[model samples]
Each structure stands twice: as structure tokens, then as C-alpha cells.
Target: MKISFLLHNAYGIGGTITTTFNLAQALATVGHTVEIVSVLRHRERPNFQLDPRVGLRPLVDLRQEKEHPQHLRPAKVFPAAEYRYRQYSELTDERIGACLADIDADVVVGTRPGLNVHLALQAPERVARVGQEHLTLDNHPSRLRTALRRAYRRLDVLTTVTEADAAAYRRKMRLPGVRVEALPNSVPDPALPPADGNAKLVVAAGRLVPVKRYDLLIEAFARVVAERPDWRLRIYGKGEEHDRLRALTESLGLSENVFLMGAAAPMEAEWVKGSIGAAASNFEPFGMTIVEAMRCGLPVVSTDCPYGPGEIIEDGVDGRLVPVGDAAAFGAALLELVQDDERRHRMGRSALDNARRFAPGPVVAQAERLMEEAIEARRAGRPVSQDRAPMRQILVGRGYAARDAVHATGSSALRTVRKGRR
Candidate 1:
């Protein structure tokens, strides 16, 4: 099978890009031909290391695209929410169609909402169209939501990272022909060894965005520092919230103990240096970082966020979970782990055991089953199954509740529609 992955920007380092690259490589290794098609290329260097077997193509050089002079009273940035709506309204050229003409793949998967709508609406009739969502439906703007409702009815399968996200789409869009599935992100196992001794260090990593809530992590760490002055916190990754978060750290007099360690290359190496991992997000569609840390044998302390953390951590077993936005509770949890060396080691060992479920081999096998199911359903002119493996069954078996069974079964059931080749 020839599979084409349509991504918004393949040049950047993001969870969506990393997961797509990993899945594509796994599919290729299993004897399927895979190609990546980027709609916009922003940088000369590819941030992800693609499998040599995978083919890569770019449709538009965004840097080269003509723009109005910046000296003029600047309108909002291109590709802003308003600009995306305007682009949707005035669909002048069929860029997606032109790109599809360049490839003869059995399946074409779109990685984001705009690309999904474009592929569903514009692709020829010979290619199977699959739309994958990395964020929740509630995160989309109203205009994009409306467009998805109208355009997605034409798509074969609509995939999201979480079951909660897929359910939201079903309820909000109310589209008949669309099938929603949950396909969480997967990462390769870490190659590094765990730290031998207590590093007295906690690590947090992600883009410094509002949703990531790194400020919350800093505040929580400040409280932890008050109790255990020897422990330190290090946050990796750079983004818009850098200045504000830095200022907050200084205000709390945590600048010395809490270091904003900017973006690090090969993040897995950084995880090895920490005694524990932290994920302080308001909502995580799928907490890839948490799993990454676990894979590196670092016990994690994450918030009981809406979808992912509860699924990943087996509270008091592999890791601890505090209520969302509760900095005090988060601090106490970290401090407890810091003070108790034996508990941290026990939890770290358990985390490694729990992470096996998300190992690339199992994850790719699940993906292959989903693809086969979608293809068979499409050929038979039937609807793909949207019923998920029960979270309760998975959690109960693992001695977890609804909130602590994140790693149970990360499977999705998206339908595939094939468009005829020109």
C-alpha cells in the first residue's frame, strides 16, 4: 500500500510531526510505501529525522510566497485565525488537488483540520482520505468547526488523539457519514540509561505555551523548594511564554533553583538527568512528554488533566497525579517524592513496566489494525466501528480508575474513502 501523509509544516519540531514521522516509518518497515507531503515549508532544515525509505515532498515554499510590505500598517499575521477563514471562503486554486496529482498513493492522511478539510474537499476520487486531529474539537475556532462539519461528511475517517476529543466532534459536528477514532501519539523507546543516584532534579519539557502552563509548574516548584531547598527544577523548550515565566520565577525568588533550560537537542538525554518528570498542562490531548519520561525510567508527577495524564499515570503506583491548577498539591507531591528516595526508585521501575503498552511495536500494530478495518469497511460500503475498547475494562484490569488508565488502549476506528485517480 502506498500511503501519503499530509502535514501543515514538516520543518518544525512538534508532537504531531514527530508522531507522524514515527508512524510513517513503522508503516514502511511493515512493507507499506509511505510518503510525506508538506503543505508549507518554513525552514530549510527538516526538524524530524525521516526514515530513509519514506519519500518527502513539499507543496509551497511559504517563505517565498509574496507578502505585503511590513512597513504598511500591518494586518494580523498570515495564517492567523481570521486569515484561515478568509482562505477557506475564497478557495481559489485547488492546491491540494495539484499535490495529489503528483502521487499515486492508496491512502492519503491529512494531519490537521485545514489540511483535512482541503483533502476531503479537493482530492481526486481515487485516493483514500483519512483526517487526523491532534487537538480537541473544543480547541478549534467556530469557523473551522463549521467547515469540518460540512467538509468532513465527505471524508472516510476522522481521527483524534483522545476519545474525549472524538466524542466532542461527534456531538458538535453532528455529521452523519463521518467516523471518529482515537489514535494517540507514539514515541520510540529511549536509548539512555537511568540516573544511578538521586540527581535532586525535576524536569519539565514542552513549548512555553499557555496550555502547557509552565508558569504553574514554576509556581509549584517554588513551593517544593521551600520545603526541600536542595532539589532543583529545570524546564526545557522555548516559546512565547519565556519572558513572563522567567519574570515569575524571579518574582518568587526561584530563579536560582528553577532554571529555564531552553530547548535541548535529543530531549531524551535531558530526561535521563532528572530524578522525576513533571507535566503541568491545563489540558493535554495526549501527554507525549510524560510517556517519554516514563520510557526513560523517570517517574512522572502530572496533573489530572482532562484526557491524557489520568490515562498514563497509575496514581501511587507508577506516578502521582494532583488536581488540575492545584499548585500546592502539585508541590507537595513533588516534595514527597524528592524526600523519599526509595519511593522514587520504586515508582520509576513501575513506570518503565507501564510504558511497555505504548512501545512502538504494539502501537504500530494497533494502527495497522485500524487501517485494515478502515480499508475493509470502505470496500464493503459500511460504516467503520466508532465503539472504543471500554476504558473501564482496561482501568479495572490495571487497578486504575477512569482517570488513571491513559495507557490502556490507544486505538481508533476511522473510516477510509478512496478517490479515483485522474
Candidate 2:
């Protein structure tokens, strides 16, 4: 089977990029033809190592194509309410549409909401259009949610990283013929041996963004430091919140106890360096870092966030979960593991064993099944009922499709007009 993934950017480092590359490589390893169609490319190569067997095709090269005719114009096909709206434009819409219209693959998966809208509205009827939601529905703006509800009806299958998000979609959105499923992100088993749960370090990694709640983690760690100053916390990742977090650490006199270790790709080494993993996010679509740490035999202590932490970590078993934004509870949870060596080691063993479910073998199997089912459904010519959405929503969705069609048709004329004016 030939599978193609449509990604916003493959050159960058992100959870979506990591998971997509992991799954694509896994598919290639199993003798299937897999390719990644990156919508934009800013760097010479991707930050993460990509398998040589898997092909990469970048549509718009940002390094050289900054002055394209329609590069500055806002995107019409991609929804304006989408978070990455400012990054997309008419040029991207055209490039992505042209690729999908002629793409040769049994399955084409979109990695983000904006790109998913493109795939759902533009991909050929014969191809299986699969959209992967890495973020929960509740996280999206109401306007964006409305847009997705209309556009997603045309999708063959919509997969969320967490089952809770899938349930939300099934209950909130009415996509009659679409198969909504939960497909956890794949994390390849580390090449190094798992951690032995002896280190005094506690590790947390992710973008140093506000939503990650690194401040909360630091506050929680302060409580731990007061009792056991020997234990240290290392946070890896670079983002806008670096200075603020550093200031907070200094203010609390935790400069020595908490260290802001900047971004480290291939965090397996870092995960093994710590005896415990930690996250204090207000929300997580799926806990990729939690699974990564668990794979390295570090039981994570994370906030029991809306969708992911509860699903990934079994409280008092493989890992511990505390209430969101509660530094006291989070600190106590960390202390529970820190104070007990035997229990920590046992939980680490359990974490390593249980995290295997997120390994490539099982995740790729689920992906293959989803793609196969979608293909079979398409081949059988199952009709998608229009009653899936209200008449108003259906018309709005059709308007989106029709507008894009018009944009494609008039591209040459608009370019000619601009050149004449110049």
C-alpha cells in the first residue's frame, strides 16, 4: 500500500512531526510505500532523523519562494480561524491543492486542522482522506470548531490522538459516514537500555510555552527541594516563556534545584538520565512526552488533564496523576515517588512494560486497519448522507469547496492582472 502524509512543515521539530515520521518510517519498514508531502520547507533537512526508505516531497520551499505572486494574500481554502492561519496563504492553498489533486496514494493523511481541511475539501474522491487531530476539540476556538464540523463531514476517517477527544467529536459533530477513532501516536522503543530508577533527577520536556505550565512544575518542585534539596529538576525545550520561568526560579531561590536545559532533540538520553518524568500541562491532546518517558522506564507524574494524562498514566500504577494547576498536589505526588525507592523502581518497571502498547508495532497495526477500512468503504461506494449536517452548515461547507474551485480556476488571470498593473 502507498500512503502519503500531508504535513504543514516537516523540517521543524514538533510532536506531530515526530509522530508522523515515526509512523511513516514504520510503514516503510513493513514493505509499504510511504511518503511525506511537506507543505512548506524552511530548512535544508528535517531536525529529526527520517528513514531513508520513506520519501519526502516538499511543496513550497520558503528558503527561495518568499516572493511568489500570491504569497502575501490570505488563504481562502484554509480556514481563517485555524491557529496557523497567518502562516498559510493563497500560494500554499494552490500548492497543496495541486498536490492532492494529482497525488498517487491509497491513503493521504493530514497532520493538522488546517491541512486536514485542505485534504477533506481537495483530495480526489478515490483516495482515502484521513485527518489526524493532535489537539482536543475543546482547545479549538468556537469559530474554528464550527468550520471543522462542516468540513470534516467529507472525510473518510478522522482519528484523534486520544479516545476522549474522539468521543467529544462523535458527540458534538455529526459526520454520519466518517469513522471517528482514537489512534495514539507511535513512539519507537529506545535503542538504549531503560533507566534503572536510581537517578535523583526529575525530567520534563516540551516547548517552554505557557500552556505547558512549566511555572507550575517549578513551583511544585520548590516544595520537593525544601525537603530534599539533593533532587534536581531539568526542563528541556525552548520557547517564549524561557525568561519568565528563569526569573521565577531565581525569585524562589530554586536556581540550583531547577535548571532550564534548552531544547534537546532525541530526548531518549535525557529521559534515561532521570528517575522520574514530570508534566504539569493545563491540557494535552495526547501525552507524547509522558509515553516517551515511560518507554525509557521513568514513571511520569502529570496533571490529570482533560484528555491525555488520565488515558496514558494509570494512577498509583505505572505513573501518578494529580489535579491540574495544583502545585501542592503535584508536589506531593512527586514526593511520593521520590521518598520511596522500591515503589518508584516497581512503577518504572511497569511503565516500561505498559508503554509498549504505544510502540510502532501496535500503533502501525491500528493505522493500517484504519486505512484498509477506509479504502474498502470507498471501493464499496457507500453514500454519505447530506443529513449529516444541518442545511445551513452543509451549504457553508459547499461554499468553501466552491470558493476554492474558483480560486484555482482564476489563478492565472489574477497573476496576469497583477503583472499588468506592475
What lDDT would each prediction earn against the true structure? 0.76, 0.87
> Residue by residue across 200-268, what tens digits does model 2's lDDT show?
999999999999999999999999999899999999999999999999999999998999999898999
lDDT, candidate 1, 199-251, per-residue tens: 99999998999989898889999888888888899999999999999999999
Model 2 ranges off by over 4 Å: 383-422
lDDT of 2: 0.87
RMSD for each model, in Å, please?
Answer: 8.0, 13.8
Instruction: Write down the lDDT that model 1 would get.
Output: 0.76
Candidate 1 regions off by >4 Å?
Answer: 66-93, 195-197, 380-382, 385-422
- Candidate 1 has what TM-score? 0.85
- Which candidate comes out best when scored by lDDT? 2
Candidate 1, number of clashes: 9
